[model samples]
Target: MRLTRHTDYALRILLQAAVEPERRLSIAEVAEAQGIARNHAMKLVNELAGAGLLATVRGRGGGFALGRPAGEIGIGEVVRLTEPDLRPADCENCALSPGCGLTPMLSGAVRAFLAELDRFTLADAAKGTRVPLLIPT
Candidate 1:
């Protein structure tokens, strides 16, 4: 299963935030660091904040930070939240829908993949070490 760019950015964003729990990062800062577009970063940041992964503060001196502790943020949960759809295929409209076992098999594979991701958290991604965040302080 391939993750969307959105999910990739979400993980990158979370990792960056987790690396510096005390610092608030702006979308521009993150975009520059990750080599992503500012608008894309902004959209992902807003969605992440809405989903409770990150906290956003407005106005001067306001920026983004992880909403919860790194250890508490599950990678799988983030993937599930960020991914638009997890279906392996549109079996409902497939020509072989009548007798296809592929859909069920594919769904099982997706479930297993997600279950594997559930084993790790943002803290795991951060490796429990304080790394220099992509966002400049």
Candidate 2:
């Protein structure tokens, strides 16, 4: 199952913010640091701001930052808010919803995916040793 670009960028934003709670960041900063497209990062940043995940500031000495505490945000919630729905493909949502055994299996897998996501929070992403944050300190 492939995640939407929005969801992927949202994760990037949150993880970027988590790395450095000492200051506010901007979509530009995140895009440059994460090596993602600036336009895409800006879109994700706006969506995250709307979702109350990050706060934005204007002007020279301003940027963006995490809206709430890191530990208070859940990975699953981010996915849910940004993704809207998680289907392996649109074909899964076709008229086959009535009696498709594959649907049930995929449904179960989705549940499992969400359950796993629920197990982690922003803190997990921030402190993760595998993919460290790229904050400017």
Candidate 3:
């Protein structure tokens, strides 16, 4: 199943943060690095912060960083937080919905997909990635 842009952006944000565990990154920095809009990055960062996946600071020299260790953050958990709908198919409007087995099959597929993601952490995803020099303003 194709994941939404929201989920994609969220993962990108996490990976960027994971790349620099010691440095706090601003939304603009992440947006520039990920090629996403600043507002979008801000929204996702706020959401991630709210969920305790990211930690945010305010005022001068304020920015964000991973809330916990990279190894402690599960990729699947991030996906679940960002992906509102995981259904692979829309069997609800189908005439054969009542008798269709596609729904359960798709559900199982989604489960399997998430389960696989659960096996990896942000650290796994950020391995060998070069950390850019971003001086927070």
| CA-lDDT, candidates in order | 0.88, 0.82, 0.90
Give a tens-digit lDDT track for model 3, residues 1-137: 88899999999889889988778899988788778999999999999999999999997789999999999999999999999888877788889899987788888999999999999999999998775566565
Deviation in angstroms for 58 in model 2? 1.2
* Residue 136 in candidate 2, Cα distance off native in Å: 6.5
All candidates in order of TM-score, best leading: 3, 1, 2
- Per-residue lDDT of model 1, residues 1-137, tens digit only: 88998899889889989988878998888888888899999999999999899999998888999999999999999999999998878888999988987988988999999999999999999985553446454
Model 1 per-residue lDDT at 93: 91
Among these predicted structures, which one has the highest lDDT?
A: 3
Cand. 3 TM to true fold: 0.93
Better of 1 and 3 by TM-score: 3
Off by over 4 Å in 2: 89-96, 129-137
lDDT of 3 at 30: 78
Global CA lDDT computed for model 2: 0.82
Q: Tell me each candidate's RMSD, in Å, in order.
A: 1.9, 2.7, 1.3
The C-alpha TM-scores of every prediction are 0.91, 0.84, 0.93
lDDT of 1 at 25: 91
Write model 2 residue lDDT over 11-77, tens digit each, in one string. Answer: 9778878877788886676788777899989888888889899998988878889999999999999
